[model samples]
Target: MSLYMLPLAIGPWQIALIVVIVLLLFGGKKIPELMRGLGSGIKEFKDASKEEDKDEKAKKE
Candidate 1:
């Protein structure tokens, strides 16, 4: 099979290890703030995409 067909192989151990690394690098307090900012950025991106779609539909109509 081609590499493109292969599923991601990450398991619980890998997830735990990554979480530990992030905690060590950013500490517990900063992680929440980072996550909040990331969430807001994603929300803004979604809103922008919806607005763009509306604009495209308006133009086509």
Candidate 2:
């Protein structure tokens, strides 16, 4: 099966369904903690990328 055959664009109904499924699976109490972890992970990834860019610039000098 080719990946191009998939309908990759997500509509509002798909988003709502995904949110509903996540709520059902994780419950209300865990969502905040999950979001916090996700946020921190993204922050660390951004910091790492910035540091890598600085290192590359330093090497080019």
Query: Clashes per prediction?
Result: 0, 0
Candidate 1 residue lDDT tens string, 1-61: 6687566767899899999999999999999999999999999999999999999999999
Off by over 4 Å in 2: 1-6
TM-scores of the candidates in the order shown: 0.89, 0.88
Tens digits of per-residue lDDT, candidate 2, 1-61, equal 4588567877899999999999999999999999999999999999999999999999999
lDDT of 1 at 37: 100
Worst 10 contiguous positions by lDDT, candidate 1: 1-10
What shift in Å separates residue 47 of candidate 2 from its native position after superposition? 0.2
Q: What residue pairs are clashing in model 2?
A: none
